[model samples]
Target: MLAIPVLAAVITIAWAADADIYLESIDKKFFNSLNKIESIFKTWFPKFSFSTEYHIENYQINSLNNESYGLLYSGGLDSLSSYIKHKKETLSLISIWGADIPLNKTKFWDKVKYKVTQLAEMDDIKCYFIKTNVREMMNENLLNKTYLEGEDTNWWLSVSHGLILTSLTSLLPIKTLIMPSSMDENEKVPHGSDLFKFMDYRWADSSLIYDCNLSRHEKIKYLLRGNTQYYQFLRVCYTQFQDYNCGMCEKCLRTITGLLIEGIDPNKCNFKVKNGFLDLIKYYLSNNIILLHSEIAAWEDIQNNIPEESSIEFSFGLKNLILMIIIIKRTIKKEYF
Candidate 1:
């Protein structure tokens, strides 16, 4: 591992000495070192301006100002909605292969590419779909090996995407990265040390991005105000491939369930899916998945009831207990079981 200091920020890079290293390069240690580096930089450079952009390489980056912004695109409803709603501003869309929801037995690549092109045309904006050698980078960074050794592929994928996005930002002029947030985390959910620890490890890791800035209400407002058709096109399921969503999968369940509580019919979505989706509502209510944050918020909205103090504390206690159980199980199993 080579530690390179840039502007007082210590950047650590793990080099592959052997044939090829995958996922293993980005381990807990690497992320920890990254946090240390970011801490140092924040102390020194209190205020910094950066821009975001996407391109095949780092071409034409110099033409952009330091304040210009860019966003990650997956041709999903979130990205599409944001693009259409923020059309007045010049935004660049960055894309990577295999980072989106998995669509089975479908030519989703073509559909996604078409969607990007169509969005660019309709919005009269410039969209850049840059393909990163993610697999290769992971191999070089040895993150692939780490992921293979680790059981949490979903978590690793988020880390991989974060590293790639951060690297892209370094190559561009952007200093801040925007991500979607849920109202549960921001308003209703009770404050707990465990919750903060989880978020700090996942979303607050600076190695994943320069400065990750998530806007919960802003994203909701954007979706509410933007093109309704565009919002309807957001795809949440990754396990199905039939042009529309499966609606039964975890992602679909979360999205549809949230929309249901928000008084929106899932059927109105461009993506078609199974009907008995409501059956899974109970399951979602029971499961402790992260996406449930939005679902809970939607539920509160539907009931038109503010979360009582006891209800908030109960939710937090439940989440914390779930986390503790998970940790205990993983420790006993010696894996992310």
Candidate 2:
């Protein structure tokens, strides 16, 4: 007679265990600061919450005598920069499922992961692949958009991914998890800001944001000094359905531009520059001012490195200007029509 109730209780307990991750006591001052930061984030989207099963109390924090390092690697430029610069100390390369890469798109994940795994192996680092249903669970079983969706839907993964990655450090003996900063110190707070990493450092297992002093452009310059072959596996394209960069997407163009300005051909890498990619590059520069402006800054920095007369057309011509005007007109018409 009591079997049904007993079974239900067992299932409930298992579900909670799976959903929540208990952590050591967090500092009271740090805990209060974390709450304030979270409150500010909540202002952007009131419906979204960063709260999870992160335990904080007055208990003493423990530390191992031997220090180990891990990094949150996504095979993207920022993470790749962090991984490569700190390759000597990085014992673990952690990649999460359904963060930016979609779980349903196994083809993309498989191909990217295979290449990244090979890169990790070359450096003798243990690559850890973690699969989670976090994204699907947050999608709310709807064909519609979630709270995190905005101008660029993929910027933030709805949850505090920094927190998620730090929480996992509890399972390991890692003393520090190096997280790559995506934006410059001067730029406005984007979706996944360094603030989250700072909070994770205080609350979750010890983690530090790597080289926030430099911008994306500066990182590419640092990468230029390293073996280009090491970064050939860098995968920045998210819109394309393939393993290789389509070379026309915003991310691809932005990254390829960085390489081009440095006198490196995108084709030599995993990026397959689309037909008339130069025209598309000009289009993005003229239209997407904010993103392209940063790329231009990178270009200016490497102007001396560029050959006097290179095949790559890093210029804005009259033809590109006309196309930009036409695109704007069409966009306006569509909006009003």
Candidate 3:
């Protein structure tokens, strides 16, 4: 059996749940960094009490190679853009099955794995496949009702995933680890994956690197510059039922709208939209079918990117789509606020 990130992974869940951990041995750097992480998170989320107690017998850490870097590749715009930016460097691509795609969804994961492997191979970068039940390890329903009830979210978003996902790569002998940003650095939305200012979340000497200075709109701009071949593998669907982008879902529609605003075709970006695709997107936006709290900023970014001079006049054009999105955003403010 391979060495797992047992101690590091458990501590992440423990932080949010305020549980006591009894681990015999763990990475020394991880132990040190997590202490700082607790302070950082507490400052960001002052409402919750994260008073986790640790009981460790010994410390076991790994040596570092300063130049080696590993990336958490999800085949999404952010990861793909990150890969494109760092293609010239020595990098390893890591993908986990249980996160985003369910462990039982082997068919979907196999396809994602194969596509990610091809991308790695093309760039002469090494690839690692991880399978873990991290997401399933804790009782979300119980946590949501108790420790996380006031949060209005489960363990995944408000806490757990940032360290949990990064911890899974603890066994990958690299000094620097990279995970793409879901929200921009400026966005005030509180999420588990938001960058920790006090810590890089070191585990076995490896440190997590989060560069969220660029917004989602800015990353999609990278795709427009002849990064075409990789576009076929883009997966931003809201469901694992689809192999690629489901243009109907809010996520897919958001990306579609972003690309459309940037003069990129959705069909070329692995999205197959029907006749009423724009209308469907409008319906989702108007009815609040998707989680709007953390999502509104991205939509606002897309809306702001729509050129004021655009007069395409088509349903999918900036003229109509921006108008619809603006109206829906106003409605969201009235309802959500």
Q: Tens-digit lDDT track for model 3 on 33-152? A: 778777777765554568777777887766655568888888888888888777676888989888788778888788889989888777778999999897777776776665554534
Per-model TM-score, in order, reads 0.52, 0.67, 0.85
Candidate 3, lDDT over the whole model: 0.70
TM-score, candidate number 2: 0.67
Per-residue C-alpha lDDT of model 1 across residues 120-183, encoded as one tens digit per residue: 6766655555444334333423543432222222223322344444344344444234332233
Which residue segments of model 3 deviate by more than 4 Å? 1-4, 16-18, 44-51, 149-152, 183-189, 223-225, 311-337
- Arranged by TM-score, best first: 3, 2, 1
lDDT of 1 at 243: 62
For candidate 1, report its TM-score: 0.52
Q: How many residue pairs clash in each candidate at the backbone level? A: 21, 0, 0
Query: Which stretches of model 2 miss by more than 4 angstroms?
Result: 1-33, 39-66, 140-159, 196-200, 203-205, 286-337
lDDT of 3 at 134: 71
Candidate 1 residue spans exceeding 4 A from truth: 1-67, 77-85, 101-106, 136-158, 169-222, 241-244, 283-337
lDDT leaderboard ranking = 3, 2, 1
